[model samples]
Target chain A: MTKIAKTSPESVRTVACIGAGVIGGGWVAHFLGRGYQVVAWDPAPDAEQKLRSLVDSAWPALERLGLAEGASKDNLTVAPTLAEAVAGADFVQESAPERLDLKADLLAEIDAALPEGVVVGSSTSGYSMSEMQVKAADPSRLVVGHPFNPPYLVPLVEVVGGEKSEQWAVDWASEFYRLAGKSVITMDQELPGFIGNRIQEAAWREALHMVAEGEATVAQIDQAMTDGPGLRWAFHGPCTTFHLAGGEGGMAHMLDHFGPSLKAPWTRLEAPELTTELRDRMVEQTDEVVDGRSTAELIAQRDRRMIAIMRALEEVEREEAAERGEGQA
Target chain B: MTKIAKTSPESVRTVACIGAGVIGGGWVAHFLGRGYQVVAWDPAPDAEQKLRSLVDSAWPALERLGLAEGASKDNLTVAPTLAEAVAGADFVQESAPERLDLKADLLAEIDAALPEGVVVGSSTSGYSMSEMQVKAADPSRLVVGHPFNPPYLVPLVEVVGGEKSEQWAVDWASEFYRLAGKSVITMDQELPGFIGNRIQEAAWREALHMVAEGEATVAQIDQAMTDGPGLRWAFHGPCTTFHLAGGEGGMAHMLDHFGPSLKAPWTRLEAPELTTELRDRMVEQTDEVVDGRSTAELIAQRDRRMIAIMRALEEVEREEAAERGEGQA
Candidate 1:
């Protein structure tokens, strides 16, 4: 393994984003909005123009979100070569296409070009860092820093290390993302699709089944979500929401009451048997999630946030309607 | 069959709510907040007190959302008997326990007492209305009007007809829900778990698998959603969100690009066969969702709404923190 370069998360000022497509361009916008100097590289002939336009379009949203001090769109540069992009970079984020061969080769190239100790984060939504790190000589510094769509707006960045990755590298990337105003979920081990994608994929597949069987329309599925569970999920997750559904009884009561229904054909996916051990763990973990807050308190907090979210959505709809009216006039 | 109730959706002055637990009590709160007199009945002795307290707790959130004209908690009454509750009632909503026998019996009882032509809606989350209406004499009037938790706040109320239900009843329930300031999704046919719960259940089951296998914690799962897809789902559903992820090409390009990964073991759930028919349907339906708007316009709308949502969340957090600090003092 090659000797790694030394750098601290706080000392990083320059970010090199390889593969300036949607996700890569998003990272450019996110970093730039945070007042960082962003250097991007992509092999596509018109990549520069597309990247610049993406940044320009995302600027107003970032401005409304309150850009970091000294943040500006002009702080971006599209490099002609990958090596030149990472030559003076303090950190690297690679968002190449999902083809494993292409990702491995590009990761290896980035590893060879990036400075000795600077951590390299791959924005692979599904691939584990272990799979991508296989071709790199210094895989110790590589970690998966998967982000959701429109990384500039969404705050989640799931971080995890490969088998060969150093725990410190994973920790550093997590801390760096947190410092950059992103909510980070750091995993101890690699899991297929990680946490978010696995849950999302399950729901997505079920939706596909509905459409395939002609059981529901795509518009109905979308409407069902935005109007129902999606409203609660804006501030709460499925687990906590269920806990609240149990009323004062909490998750334990919820499991006991609804455990039998798990066998019901709610979705195409069969649930794991609610064994004693699984039941205990879920009940325990959910209690830990409750974290000393009473069910009533949690419900109150949820209501407050949900009410605020609805108001915000209403305001947005009003603004859009007003803008449309103005355009029509 | 007993002659049906004769009240129209417009003349629904008083709503009879049977089985006053969480969902039933929520219906009570919802109707009361919409300026309707609500008479509630439950077998449990303490249900009246519990229902009142729930309404009291939910009132503040409803107030924040702006109560309808003349809406008040004083509009509610705790009826001693099921017959008393539905006497002269213009509409009946049954929120009994999820037991099929109990629901069928309750529906029959409500049907026997309700005025002619008045529609009776069951708040059954999973059981199809067909099964519940099996024992009712006037099954044509029974429809499912399932609402999410805390019915007073969340706007979604899914309306669907049973095999025996009249299309007019389904349409009336849907219209009534809309008139009450609730978002309504009317379904043409019965499907197990309806739409929202199926999608939610699929995700929930996947989450249970993770916790069952020790792959992730409950907190991590919740965090993954709240920080990731949950933000987007507040305004956009999974399909539209995927459509946006396709960049300029929209859902068609997305299906072509990521369709292969459907076979990946992202979740234990098996995806449906992505035949050409399904593909064309999804593409066409998603295009319908998009209507005449360009991908760029949709992205900009998504960004504006997301930014507003984030700001709303931040503000709520600050208020909660301040309250906690005040409590400490």
Candidate 2:
């Protein structure tokens, strides 16, 4: 069972993004900003226009982050069909709707048309890659390259493989993602919701319980983070933060001190019954916070803020890297 | 019962910070930056020197964040004793050690020395204010003003009252904290960790379970957040983020779609057994990530990066305020 080694991501100049909705279109914009000639396709009739608009909306942020040489909107081409989109592509990302059947069919179709060793990554947030790879002829090269929202701005990409996936494919995808300016987490085992979503879901569940019990408002919960732990998380992970909390003793001391409180009723692990009352309260609270802006407006504000944060981190990161004399590439 | 109406926080010109550890020292620096005359005292022999050095290290970041018209290091006075620290102070912030007995005795001591109607706020991260207020002669004026690490940079200070604490005291403390440049959450009722610490503890417990079970490394777990959901958290909290995930339907659709997964085996609500094996693994992994940097070095890096993130958020916040003519005052 010999394996086909993958190409160096730096050597791959053209990329393909299939099913260009919000997630796919974000990938298209991100790739284009990195100077990759992007071939995009979606079955929807208005897909081309929507994708182009998203690219345009995202460009200013990319420019602020500093675009790669030769990067432009002109570099993105909308193909009429999937085969044409992946015909000569070096990498393909499938971001179809979350229907498991739809994703299985879409991934298999991309696999059939693509050349060997050209990895096909999925943008599905929660689906297991093994389930999506079942219908593919060459499932060995399929990998999950899950990203957070506004993929063009956020640098994280969770890279993992299916049961049928080859180790080399996962390795290649992780390396490619890093070269593409993403913070890559390569997971050794498959877990429901992966790593990031799982941690997020736990916190989300607890937050809902808080709202259901009428302990806090949606606004207060948001403030608790953006003004508190979230600031620490920007530079360090939760583990690191807690380790810092341990003072000089590190995680060991922290666990011994705060370990008993973990079992206290600080959190409700069970799902809170989201009754109609809770639902309306959530909607109304969010509406009050939104204060007459559309979802698009909220998203645009988020993007603008996200860009500022990334640039701030980059300012220090670039300096630290220069001092170390290590080329980022 | 009739309430004693609190005075306006803008009238506060002097602040007393007792027991000057990191959190206490941070309060001193933050108050000084807001242009208040700061009087601080600590029992440790080197406390004055350590406190002064901390304020000096943080001064540059606070300067970048912009200081009040009269803000200066020259305004700080390290008192010879706790009684002197609170003498003639317009407000008091107590940041003694986390021990309940020590805090109870200390709060009572401060209460006896404080003038009528002046509020005294504690900096305990997890203890209930009521527990700490038990021994105080004037418990009505005691409130919890829990803050995250490096309080000079992070703006959140969870303010809440104990069973004996007066409403006016909590209100006065909250408003005073806001005027002092802290984002204040005045909780209605006392819970174990207040809102921010409760939410953070839930995530921390789940993360520890992952590490204990050998499902993920300490570094990988941290990576999962800093790269993924942590990005969204900087702008929005968990509830708002899940609402965004629901597409146009908001939290209702999100609850309906992903609510069932809340009960899945994704989290270990009970504390994981922190046996020596688990403890050693955590320590070693953290050391590797620290990469020979002393804890002091790690903390310095965190402080520098934290200042960068806060400044980034402030840039947009200031802009949005100007557009709305709020003046950020």
Candidate 3:
């Protein structure tokens, strides 16, 4: 095996996106908006049109966030085939459907076709990179670079590598995501659901239990978070929030106060049986909350709101940066 | 028993904030910033000066958010005693220490001194209104109006009534909080720890479990959240974020896909025993994250970031309100 050095994040200009559904299309838009030449491919016949539409819809919001120098939708090229998409690309992002065998095959194909040492990433939400890397030829360079929905706007991207993956590739992906204006979490190991989804799934399951038990309506639960801890979550995680809640003692004092309550029968991590009755109640309650908005309409609304938050956070960061520079001067 | 009519939220001009710790001082700053005359009381001899200092420290950020008409620190008055604070108050907010006995005695004193039908809300994070109301002469008006830290910035206020609480008093408190620009979750029943704290406690326990197992560091866990799902959490609760993640099919599809993985035992809701070793590690890791910054500095940073997020959210809300008004027109 020839030793390979990892690609520099800034040196990579042309990026490839495979599978152009919501996640993939969002990636395409994000890359294009950041001044990367994005070549994308999807098996769906209408994927090109849909990808373009996703990019178009995201453009106005991206424009507000300020695009990278020379960044334009004209930088995107929708390839007709997977191989064509990755043929001359410096990096590849596979956002295929969530089937294990399908992802394994897709990653293997991209691995076989890619140039030596050119790393490839999967935008998988739950699949561990180890499971998907089993079939890849250059498994050492394949990493999981999981991103949240509307990836063009949300700053988070969980980057990790499988057992077969080399450290440099993971580092490359982390740096690349950061360079692309993302807040990246590079995991030391291939934790299931990475880190984000596990916490989310835990909380989501508890929420389902609450709904199933009629402890709270869907609307009330949403309000409980949005108007409560969710606000703090925007800037700090649960641990840090607890640290702050600890007053001057920090996390130690927090544990002493609430440690016993953690054992109380307040939250159940087990998935509630999704009975038809429960399902109907949730759907009805959610429909009531959402008020007859189509999925597309809801998605648009989410994207718009996400943009506002991202822009606001960005402005704060920029202002803080300027202030720090002034202080240093 | 005669039923009390709810006090008009708009009629509230003077508010009383009892206690002058961080939470109480925050409430005083919030009330004054909202253009209400705030009369505050605390038993500590230095409380008056401390309360004034807190309000002064918080004033600049509040000013950036744009003060309510006539809002000023001059509106805050440090009352000589608890009774004097509530003497001419339109509403009373109790943010006494978290000890139940102290709060019980304090609430009873306030109830004895308050004008008839004036609602008194306690900012208790752990105790239910029912527990705290046990000592009050008029328990009906002693509802829980729990706000997050730095109550002046976070919009969430969990309002719940005790068993003896009058429906009209709860309604009056809810309307008053909303009028003052707070998001109110009028919980139907007093569940232990209320809703937000339970969820937070659950997640906090799991985070401790990970820390004990050496799965991640304090910084890693925090980054895993703030740079990962924490962003979405700002706008959507866990359920909605998962629903959005399930593609066009919604929550039902999401439940079917990821529900079982939840039971894989990644998270332990039962509290992990906080060993001295674990506690030390947490303190040290947190110290590294805090990086020699004083607690006061960390709080200032948190407050600044929170104000930025709040202002941004306010902007989005203002635009949406305008859009809705146009639609109605």
| DockQ comparisons of all candidates to the true complex | 0.86, 0.24, 0.21
TM-score of each: 0.97, 0.79, 0.79
Q: What lDDT tens digits, residue by residue, belong to model 2 across residues A68-103? A: 899999999999889999998999988898889999
lDDT of 1 at A282: 86
Tens digit per residue, CA lDDT, model 2, B80-142: 988888877888999998889999999998988777778889999758998999998879989
True contacts kept of 2: 0.51
Which ranges of candidate 2 are over 4 A from the true structure?
A260-265, A269-329, B1-7, B260-266, B269-329
Chain A: TM-score in each model: 0.97, 0.81, 0.81
Considering TM-score, where higher is better, how would the candidates rank from best to worst?
1, 2, 3
Local accuracy of candidate 3 as per-residue lDDT tens digits, B169-287? 88899999999988888888877766776666556555555555446556666667766666566645665555555554445455556445545555553223333443333333333
Q: State the number of backbone clashes in model 3.
A: 0
Q: Ten consecutive residues with minimal summed lDDT in candidate 2 chain B?
A: B278-287
The CA lDDT of each predicted structure is 0.90, 0.76, 0.73
The runs of at least 3 residues in candidate 3 whose Cα sits more than 4 Å from the true structure, single-residue gaps closed, are A256-266, A269-329, B5-7, B256-329
